[model samples]
Target: MLDFTNDSSGGEPSSQAVKQDAISDQALLDAYSNAVIDVTERVGPAVVRVETGSKTPGARERGGLGSGIVISPDGLVLTNNHVVGSSRQIRLRDNEGIVTEARVLGVDPDTDLALLRADGARELRYASLGNSKSLRRGQLVVAIGNPLGFESTVTAGVVSALGRSIRSVSGRTIEDVIQTDAALNPGNSGGALVSSAAEVIGINTAIISGAQGICFAVASNTAQFVLSEIIRHGYVRRAYIGVSGQTAPIPRRHAVAAGVDNKMGALLAQIEPDGPAARAGLLPGDVAIRLDGVDIHGVDDLIRALDRDRIDRTLEMEVLRMGRLRTIDIHPIERKPSARQGSAP
Candidate 1:
């Protein structure tokens, strides 16, 4: 008779070790499944199926559609603008299979984000946005959306990478995009890329065709910024500053003199002529110290400070010019369509 618990000749208990390994493997798999299921259940109600069709005169009628996620209790939804594709006729279907008419409130082609309103519905379940900056590679994330017309389709994978840059169909650069290995189908656009805590960390938008598990989502931080601006202004009102800058470390003495604990500041690489900075008498070689009382830590800080509300508003800019600190109140104007935003040189 053969003893299954151990190797009889060596008595090493090989079978027991194998059994333990199998148990551990099974436990890990169970944990993964549970996490995906939890996130799906939590955000499922907010995930929506967006169906779009053209209503133009003498054009192809009712052709394109995509997924969307409700962002407000009042039935405001967020989706990819590319999904709507020149069609204002949108209809939303919630996880409960309740179909409702949706109106396009606003859309930003540059960011590929569009805002829609479900007709007269309130108290709808919405997703809580999370910080994408806190994401790390290999972190577990799940994609919940209407993939290929399958409503509430849930797929699970890890964050394959972070800080990726992808260009939208509108030729705008989308920065700080979250890349994941989750299987995304054609209709997964505008879905929720949720974290383990069931918070939306990114908005699923694009997937590499013919590639396996290569997908990209707009960062939740960017989505949050755009969503707020769209809700407030009916569009993303970006303030364009005429300077291209890179983050550089300021001298300890300079930092101390500026009363800032952060040693880094924006090093101007180029300044647009006749722009807000130039109009305010800001010259090249000036290191930004602060904008609107916010510490000048880096270029990203400056960009964050110049949101839609800052447009046409006078901001007290503190800068170190030629070793002398000076304050300039500059009024930034709304960025015109076709005006280079992101970082202008």
Candidate 2:
């Protein structure tokens, strides 16, 4: 007679082992749920609904609506510049249903970030910005925002990519952007993209329309820089060497001849007449390899090197022109607000 009894040592997992595996799986699921719950409980209160409008007689009653996060106990709120636009009046409503008037402290349209101060608000709940540089792909993140007029909605996702570049409404490229799979909608802009530790790692900014699971946020490091500059000055002071450029591959022969280790460079496609580059003898075809001893492998690299401190300062720019290395002394000037025509180096 064939053996009717079930064998415990068979290839299939035993009942006891299966029970233990189920328990482990449940534990992991519980941990993930608990983390989301904890972050929501801690950081959700700081997320506020931002409403902007113009008080003009003929202007629209409600101009724009989005989300913001209070980053200081004294109610310093951070949001997206696009959300506020050119509105003259801004109102904020916290999670507790307390409404307050806010005024724009400053705005950096290049980074798509804005800072606001709640009028006469004191001792308000706030969230802390975390180090976004430490974030890795696949790390869990939570997004808290007001989507489609809904207040304090939370969604969880993972960091899909890093070091992304996105274009701001002002037609500037925002570098080091964080890409995530978090579900974001029309009203989610200017909200908080939080890490599992309940720290604001990024500011939820843009969502690609017609694309699923593709969203972006301004990294907290970039936001922090914008915040400090706006607090100290009314606007971000960027150094400009007037030129329009694109990243181009350095020819192997040219790289070897010029003794440059860079595989790519910012090819100066156009130079403004009488601008810094033109005055410094930098031609349109010059490929910049270094700026003041710093590598300029691409346009973004060159842009970052020309910060506020570099304004009015003469810097040595290393370029490869006609397969020969040349050093040009260029003086960077303060970028004018009206000169937003092309990419400012």
Candidate 3:
């Protein structure tokens, strides 16, 4: 939840020792800037210009511009679903100045991913997909998109972090996210974050307010899955369990001090009636310790575990119940499309 949206003031330290940190950071930036842009420019033409028109009651037509990626040869485009939310008209312009009307193939508001199709478009270029699983801190990456309607704009930086979760303006929590220092602006959503080889590793999605140079993106794998669903079902099928919990690892000192009396797992603070947790015999005071054999450290770990699962998938969970450890097998329910905006439990 590091807010990196709008602060442009450089964070320079006011001390001599800190000068070394600044020097090292600058060196990394220099390397990234010198090397990444060439690849971005070569592959950027496939990223399209998205123009959306909307009208409200008693209002004139409103228009906005965003960016999208070509995902298929016959003109399947991928973009942030928020960009096209309820728009009356959508137009796509590729790098060659060819503009065409497009239609939404599917929209997944939960992931903020949408698929669009432009008829009769041929020989469309596609960025190679990089394995998000292989992304590591300090690895270089480049973001290409249209910010302020400038097509194929490129910014370079390293993989600042991973496994982040951010809530979009549309109120859906995007999870398993990537964070970087690449500059992403208003019109950059759904553009590509590529590696040195021009493989699209991430989808530039959001930037935090009041912070400079910090940006977030959806990992390419997540985008691929969500986009595929948009093409097939016009929606994503997400699994849900009925429990609300904050992620905190069991502290060793707290365990020692309490002598087995205190909970030693993820603290469950709420439960919904007849929900998956309640139906599975879990209650308010339970602390979930493990999922399917994976140790649960915090909320992100649990969320990452459950985010993409299908409905009715059985998950083995170990929990702390009344000062004792207990195990349960819980079947996740299909979270209705309407409830996607609500907390799970």
Cα-based lDDT for every prediction: 0.83, 0.91, 0.77
Q: How many backbone clashes does every candidate have?
A: 1, 0, 8
Worst 10-residue lDDT window for candidate 2 reads 336-345
Q: Against the correct fold, how does model 1 do in TM-score?
A: 0.70
lDDT of 2 by residue, 93-143 (tens): 988888899999888888888999999735679999999999999999999
1 versus 3: better lDDT goes to: 1
Descending-lDDT candidate ranking: 2, 1, 3
lDDT of 2: 0.91
Q: Which of 2 and 3 is ahead in lDDT?
A: 2
lDDT of 2 at 118: 93
Clashing pairs in 2: none
Best by TM-score: 2
Estimate, for each residue in 6-54, the C-alpha lDDT of model 1 and write its tens digit: 4466666586787999999999999989988888888999999998874
User: Any idea how many clashes model 1 has?
Assistant: 1
Candidate 1, residue 203: CA error in Å?
0.4
Using TM-score as the yardstick, the better of models 1 and 3 is 3
Error of model 3, residue 63, in angstroms:
3.9
| TM-scores of all predicted structures | 0.70, 0.86, 0.72
